[model samples]
Target: MTLNNDYFKARLEELREELLAELAVAGPHPESGHGYSTHPADHGTDAFEQTAGIAVRRNAERLLYEVERALTRIEENRYGICRDCGQLIDRARLKVIPYARYCLDCANKHSKG
Candidate 1:
C-alpha cells in the first residue's frame, strides 16, 4: 500500500507543536520562596511540582524524538511501513498515533514478548 505523506506530515507537525508547548511549561524557574525555611506544605507542593515537571519534560522529549523519526521516515519514503514486517501500517492506527514504527500485530507481539 502507498504511504500518505501529506497526512503524516500534518500529524507530525501537530505533535511537534504540542511537544514544544509542553516543554515551554516544563522549563525551569527560580524557587518561589526563600530556601530551607519553607513550611512543610510548601515543600510538599514543591516536590510534587518538581516531579510533575520532570515527567512532563521527559514525555515531551520522547514525543519530540518520535516526531523527528516520523519526519525522517517521510524523507526516506518509508513513513507508513512497519519496520518489523515491511507491511503497510493501518491508516486508523496512523491517525491515532502517527509516530508508530510497527503495525498492530508486530506491536502486540513485541509487547507480549
Candidate 2:
C-alpha cells in the first residue's frame, strides 16, 4: 500500500519542531563559552555537559537534514522511492523512519561495503 503524504509531512513537521526546540534549549552555540564554571568538579560537570550538548546538536542537525530532504521529496513527488535502487520503499519502514532514503536491502548492502 502507498504511504500517505499528509501523514509523512505532518510527522516531518513535528520532528522539525522538536529538533528546533532541543537546539534552542541546548544553547545552540558551543563556542561562545556561555556556561563556564570555575570549580574543579563543576568544571568537569560543565565539560561533560558541553560534550553532551554538542552531541545533541549534531544529532538534531542530522535528523533535520533528513527531514528536510523528505519534505523536499514530498514536494517533488518523489517520496517513498529508494535513492540508491530506484524502487518503492516499504510502507512499514517508512512509517518507522519517514526520512529514510534507501530501502532495507540497499541500506544493509551499502552499510556493509
Candidate 3:
C-alpha cells in the first residue's frame, strides 16, 4: 500500500517543532569555571552541573539530528519506506515513530543484531 505523504509530513513537522522546543529547554552550557574556584566543595558542584548540562545538551542534539533526518526523508519522498528491507512501513508504526527507518520485521532483526 502506498503511504500517505501528507500525514507523514505533518507528523514530521510536529516532531521537528517538539525536538526544537526540547533543545531550547536544554539550552547552551555555561562556560566552565565561570563561578568555580579551587575550593573543593565549590569545584565539585560546578563540575557536576557542567557535566549534567553537557549530557542533556548531547541528548537534545541527537534528537534534533533525528528530527532533521525525518524532514529530509519527507522531502525526498522516501519517508515511509523501510531503509533496511525496501518495504512500506506499517502505518501504525509510523504513527508511533514518524522517523522510523525500518519496518517491523527489519526493526526486530536490527534490534537482535
Candidate 4:
C-alpha cells in the first residue's frame, strides 16, 4: 500500500521542529565559554558534561539532517524508496520513522557492516 503523503509531511515537519528546539538548548558552547563552569575544581565535571553535550548535539544534528533529506525526497517525488535497494519501503516503517532512507532489508544489511 502507498504511504500517506500528508502524514509523511506532517510527521517529518514535527520531528524537524523538535530537533531544532533540542539543539537550541544543547549544552555549553565550550568555544564561546557560554555554559562552562568557572571554578578550576569543577573543570573535570565540566569537561565530561561538555563531551556528553557535544555528542548530544551531534546526534540531534544528524537526525535533523536525515529529516530534511526526507523532506527533500518528498518534494522530489522520491520518498519511501530505499536508497540502496530501490524498493518501496514498508508503510508501517515509514509511519514509525518518516525519515528512513532504506527498506528493512537494506537497512539490516547496511547496519551489519
Candidate 5:
C-alpha cells in the first residue's frame, strides 16, 4: 500500500511544534532552586523532583531529535523507507509511528543486535 507523504508530514510537523512548545515551557524555569525550603525533607523532595524533571526533559530532547531527523528524511524523499534495507516501511507501522525509519523486520533485527 502506498503511504501518504503529506499526511505523515503534517502529523510530524504537528508533533514537532508540540514538542518545541513543551520544551520552551519546561525550559528556563528551574523551580528546584527557586524558593526552596530549608527543611531537610524539602531538600530531598526538591532534589528528586529535579532529577525527574531532568529525565523528562532529556527524553523530550531525544524525541525531538528523532522527529527532526524524520522530517529531514521526508524532505529528502526518503521517508517511509527502511534505512538499512531500502524497502518500503509497512503502512500500519507508519500509521502508528509516522517517524519510523525502519521496517518491522529491520527494527526487530536492530533491537536484537
Candidate 6:
C-alpha cells in the first residue's frame, strides 16, 4: 500500500512542536534553584526538584530527536520504510507511532539484540 506522506508529516510536525514546548517548559528557570537554605528538608526538596526537571528535559530531548529524524526521513522520501531491513513498515504501526523507522519484526529484533 502507498504511504500517506502528508498525514505523517503533519503528525510528526505536531509532535515536534509539542516536544519543543515540553523541553522549554522543563528547562531550568532562574527561580528553580537551591538557595542558601540550611534546612535539610528544604535542601532535599530542592535536590528532588532539580532531578525531576533534568529527567523531564532529557526525555523531551530524546523524543524531539526522534521526531526530527522522522521529519527528515519524510523529506527524503524514506518515510514508512524500515531502516534496518529496507522493507515497508506496516500502515497500522505508522498510524500509531507516526515516527517509526523500522517494521515490527526489525524493531523486535533490534530490541532483542
Number of the top lDDT candidate: 2
Candidate 6: regions farther than 4 A off: 1-3, 28-46
Which candidate gets the maximum TM-score versus the true structure?
2
Off by over 4 Å in 5: 1-3, 28-45
Instruction: Please provide, for model 2 over 1-113, each residue's C-alpha lDDT reduced to its tens digit, 9 standing for 90 to 100.
Output: 44699889988899999999877766646656763443234344466787887888889989999999999999999999999999999989999999999999999999999
- Model 4, position 73, has a per-residue lDDT of 96
Model 5 C-alpha RMSD vs. true structure (Å) is 5.3
Query: How do all models score by TM-score?
Result: 0.79, 0.85, 0.72, 0.80, 0.78, 0.78
Model 4: residue 54 alpha-carbon error in angstroms: 1.5
What lDDT is obtained when candidate 4 is compared to the true structure? 0.83
- Candidates in order: C-alpha RMSD to true structure: 5.8, 4.3, 6.0, 4.6, 5.3, 5.7
For model 6, residues 3-110, the per-residue Cα lDDT tens digits are 499988999999988988876655445245633244334343566666776777788888888899999999999899999899999999998999898999999999
> What ranges in model 2 sit over 4 Å off?
35-45
TM-score of 1: 0.79
Q: How far out, in Å, is residue 10 in model 5? A: 0.6
TM-score of 3: 0.72
What residue pairs are clashing in model 1?
A: none
Q: How accurate is candidate 6 locally (lDDT)?
A: 0.80
- Backbone Cα, N, C clashes tallied per candidate: 0, 0, 0, 0, 0, 0
